[model samples]
Target: MRRKYNPYALPPWLKKSRDVLHQFAIPFCIFQGIRTILFPTAFDVLFLIALVLITVALKIELL
Candidate 1:
């Protein structure tokens, strides 16, 4: 008889990270959805501001 391998198991670190990111993404998506409904035009502005801040932080750390 031959043994079978299973793919259901994942590495500890990957599973932890996946759970944490999933939790964070749910709230983030909800917030953005509400913002877009309230102020459709402002939603883009808010997203751009967040993108700029993230890029700035990355650049600062890289320098």
Candidate 2:
């Protein structure tokens, strides 16, 4: 059986960092999206996709 996830079990420092990343995810995604639009490189497109996925995961508490 799989164990239940417990956010409270995370260390204080890790929790703080997670909070910080959670807060920044959206802006980072937006910036990356704009950068991708301007440049349209393969790497930029891939990176923007990854950023969007990460932002979604963070919002849904899956990360």
Candidate 3:
């Protein structure tokens, strides 16, 4: 059987860090998106994709 997940079980510092990253994920994705649009490089594209996936995961509380 799988154990239930609990955010409150995380340490204070770790919880804070997760909150900070959760807040910043969107802006980071936006910036990377614009950068990728302007430069159109392979690395930029890949990075933007990764950022978008991470942002989605964070928004959905799956990360």
Candidate 4:
């Protein structure tokens, strides 16, 4: 029989905060994206960028 590989097993922290991000960040990004589209502005652009960067940092366990 073959065994399945697990990335989270290699590093326990890899799956850390997985639920939190899914429950909050993902949905927030969708709403924020819509708001930025309807009312485009410099602050909205910066906020979107910040959100994306923060999501990436959290995904890589940097923050």
Q: Which candidate leads in lDDT?
A: 2
Cα deviation in Å at residue 61, candidate 2? 0.7
Write one digit per residue (lDDT tens) for candidate 4, span 1-63: 996755556555545556567457767777889999999999998898888887777677655
lDDT of 1 at 53: 55
Summed backbone clashes in each candidate are: 0, 0, 0, 0
Question: Candidate 4 clashing pairs?
Answer: none
Q: Which ten residues in a row have the lowest lDDT in candidate 4?
A: 6-15
Query: What's the CA RMSD of model 2 in angstroms?
Result: 0.8
Candidate 4 lDDT (Cα, whole model)?
0.74
Worst 10 residues of 1 by lDDT: 54-63
Task: Compute the lDDT of residue 57 as modeled in candidate 1.
Answer: 46
Residue pairs of candidate 2 with colliding backbone atoms:
none
Q: What is the lDDT of residue 54 in candidate 1?
A: 48
lDDT (10s digit) by residue, model 3, range 9-50: 889998899899999999998998888888899999999889
Relative to the true structure, candidate 3 reaches a TM of 0.88
Compared with the true structure, what per-residue lDDT tens digits does model 1 show for residues 1-63?
A: 995643246688866765565446545656766777777886566885665554454445321
lDDT of 2 by residue, 1-63 (tens): 999988899999989999999999999989988888888999998998898898898899987
TM-score each candidate.
0.41, 0.92, 0.88, 0.60
TM-score of 4: 0.60
What value does the lDDT take at residue 51 in candidate 4?
85
TM-score of 2: 0.92
